[model samples]
Target: MKIAVDAMGGDFAPQAIVEGVIMAASSLPADTQLVLVGRQDIIKELFQKHGFESSAVEIVHADDVIEMSEHPTKALSQKPNSSIGVGFKLLKEKAVDIFCSAGNTGAMHVGALFSIRAIEGIIRPAIAGFVPQVNGKHAIMLDIGANADCKPDVLSQFGEIGSLFARHTLHIDHPRVALMNIGEEEQKGSVIAQAAYQLLKENKRIQFVGNIEGKDLFTDKADVIVTDGFTGNILFKLGESLYGILKERGIEDEFIARTNYESIGGSPIIGVNGNVMIAHGISSPLAIKNMISWARQQVEANAYIHIAQALA
Candidate 1:
């Protein structure tokens, strides 16, 4: 399998990204290759400065870069030679099994939709985030900043998408799917949630558990949580802030440590035709390395294929 890394995407471009690729190259399977997409000269210099020589690593030159503040659609169309743009091209051509970036989240989302497109029968693609569980396992949450406002049917499809993701990536058998709501009752939440509950309840693709409250996020009550992007994005950021606060207080614990974004690496843009992982903008070398591993795992699990089958 070949995984493409956007060497220019993150805040710590080229340097941290190159370091992470080197780290991943050392441990990755001999047959697996790491393709770095960015300026060829700079990448080679970093590789040499780091005293790394591996045939499994390749570099694809992309002269331009999409700035963090640039408009997603405009940057993609105007700068066809940008690292993110080139990476998507490679993905579309099947040159890489997975494409990952820690740069602009919006750009990545836009690129995925425009380049690879969504799976057939999928109303909208959802971004899946990992929620740390108390039992040392992880639960999957969907629609995390992908579609801020979704219809009831779209939310229900998020359940199926999240369920398939958990089953394939988390290796869960018959993963319990739950809708995030204010109360545990089916009739709770807004009109959309109430309507989504009925659709999810009748859907046989997933094991639909009733509603799951915010407090139940880290519990074993649900293996997959579905919610609108607006709510899920807020919750996702809150979790990140909580981790930062705990670390600032010098509090150390295994469960809290699991809350680190580095540990989770990145979130996958599921329901898309090809594999695309989007990491945090401030991702460190360790985070990038973990993202590569997560991407490889998804490919090995045949995640997209299973998701297509489930949606079908």
Candidate 2:
């Protein structure tokens, strides 16, 4: 399998990405290849700086770069040779099994939508975040930041896709799906939440477990947690912040260690046509290395194909 990574799309740019690629290349399977998309000269220089050379790693030249502050659509359209642009191009052409970036979040999201596109019958593709559970496993949370405002039907679709992702990718049989809300009761949240609850309950394809409150997020209450992007994004970030907050106080916990962003490295944008991972813009070399590992899992699972089949 080949995984394409945007080399010039992050805060640290070529340095961190190249170093991370080197770190991952050392441990990758012999059959797997890492494709670095960026300026060839700079990428090679960085590799030489680290005194590293590997046949497992290849560089794909990209003449331009989309700044973090640039508009996603505009940058992608104007800069076809940009790292993000070339990465998506390779994905669309099936040259790589996966494309990942720790650069602009909006650009990554847009690039996926405009490239291989969403799966058939998908209302809107959602970004799924891996939430660390108390049981030493992770729960899949949908619309983590993709669709901030979701209708009842859209929210219901999140449950269905989230369940499929959990089953195939996480290897959970009959995953229990739950809606993230203010209360555990049926009538607890806003009008949209109440409506979404009924829709999710009526859906037989998923094992809907009703609503779960914020307190139950990491308690292993459900295998899949459904929430609008607005709420889900806030909750996901708040959960991720535990590691930094606790570390500053000289506190170390086994479960808290999993909260570190570098552990998982990146979050996959589910319901898309192909594998696409979005890592934190502030991702470290460790995070990129881990991201590449997780990307392999995603490619092997091929959840998007299963999701498209299920929808059909």
- lDDT over C-alpha atoms for residue 169 of model 2: 92
Per-candidate TM equals 0.98, 0.99
Clashing residue pairs, candidate 1? none
In the range 1-312, model 2's lDDT, one tens digit per residue, is 999999997888879989999999999999899999999999999998999999999999999999999999998899888999999999999999999999999999999999989998999999999999988999999989989999999999999999999999999999999999989889989999999999999999999999999899999999999999999999999999999999999999989999998999899999899999999998889999999999999999999999999999
Give the range where candidate 1 is weakest over 10 consecutive residues by summed lDDT.
302-311
Residue 47 of model 2 has an lDDT of 93
lDDT of 1 by residue, 1-312 (tens): 999999998889879999999988889988799999999999999999999999999999999999999999999999989999999999999999999999889999999988988999999998889988889988888989989999999999999888888888889999999999999888899999999999999998889998999999888789999999999999988887777899899998898888889987899998999899999888889999989998998888868888887667
Candidate 2, 118: how far from true, in Å?
Answer: 1.1
- lDDT leader: 2
Model 1: number of backbone collisions: 0
